[model samples]
Target: MTKATLQRRPLVKQILANADDNLLVIGGLGSSNWDITEAGDRPLNMPMWGGMGAPVGMGLGLALAQPSRRVLVITGDGDMLMSLGSLATVATQQPDNLAICVLDNEKFGETGNQATHTSPRNNGPTDSGAGTDLAMVARGCGIADTGTVREASQVAQLVKDLRAAKGPIFRLVKVMVEKLEFVMPPQDGAHLKDRFRQALLGHP
Candidate 1:
């Protein structure tokens, strides 16, 4: 089936609009970081600036530590692909409060838009073979609540699943490739950590 065209900013805004104080969001570096900040800068949101594949692992740890809070990891496809094995580990641990959403533009947006494994390739030198199906990989790793979101119509359900699905859930959201201006959050790592810690734990 052909994928629907969706913009990352609106989709992210819609998802976060429904979120509450109990939602602990961990954003992957680069575009994912900007997207979440664009949605809204909250004390509960932790946007990583350097860690490439750390969001999922960090979200898992946070979820395990705070079982009552819903942990959402927002990352790019390239970042998620780098830590593919972490999916298996997440499945093994089966943290019910954790969910992962990959904003898959199918290219390495941060590094000169290089085609990632998730990018579709034809028979040519540039081909990296067929595009990787991340939702399938997540399901194969025992995440039963997994899906790909390519339509605006799917956004509502995606938000609902992120909030209430039996996790560790995974979703691959196909977003458009656009050069939007960066919407940055506070870049101070220590400050971000202190703010998020204070919001979630009531103390920095």
Candidate 2:
């Protein structure tokens, strides 16, 4: 079946615009980081500048630590594939407040748009031999609330799921392959950590 065409910027904007102050967002490296920054930077938004596949684990820890708050991890297919084992760990921990959204463009956007495993074979020069279904992988890892969002109409429910679903929820959003200018947040890791800490804990 052919996939629906959806842009990353608008979808990301819609999702983050509805987020309440209690939502703690962690953006994985590369385009995911830039996408969140384009949405608008907040103290609660932690855009990882270096970590490749660490967002899920980090977000899980945050969700476990702050049981009252919602933790959203937005990452790419390449990043998620790099640490597939983390999905099982998250399922084992079962943090009810944690949700993960993978922006599956099927390419390693930061690394010259190389195809990831999720890319369909023969689709292009960068296509993979077997396109991985990430939502299925998450479900196999014991996350029952898993889905793939390929339509713009589903964005509302996805946003709701991220905020209120009985998590750890996992969603694979198939975004269009587009070249966009980078919208960066604060690059200093310490400053980003301090701001996020202050916003969530009232301490630097």
Q: Name the candidate that leads on lDDT.
A: 2
lDDT of each: 0.91, 0.92
Backbone clash pairs for candidate 1 read: none
Cα displacement (angstroms), candidate 1, residue 79, comes to 0.4
Clashing pairs in 2: none
Predicted structure 1, TM vs. truth: 0.95
Worst 10 residues of 2 by lDDT: 121-130
RMSD of each: 1.7, 2.4
Which tens-of-lDDT digit does each residue in 1-204 have in candidate 1? 365489999888887886788899999999999999999999999999899999999999999999999999999999999999899989999999999999999889999999898878786586665788999999998888899999888889999998878799999999988899999999999999999999998999
Kindly state the number of residue pairs that clash in model 1.
Answer: 0
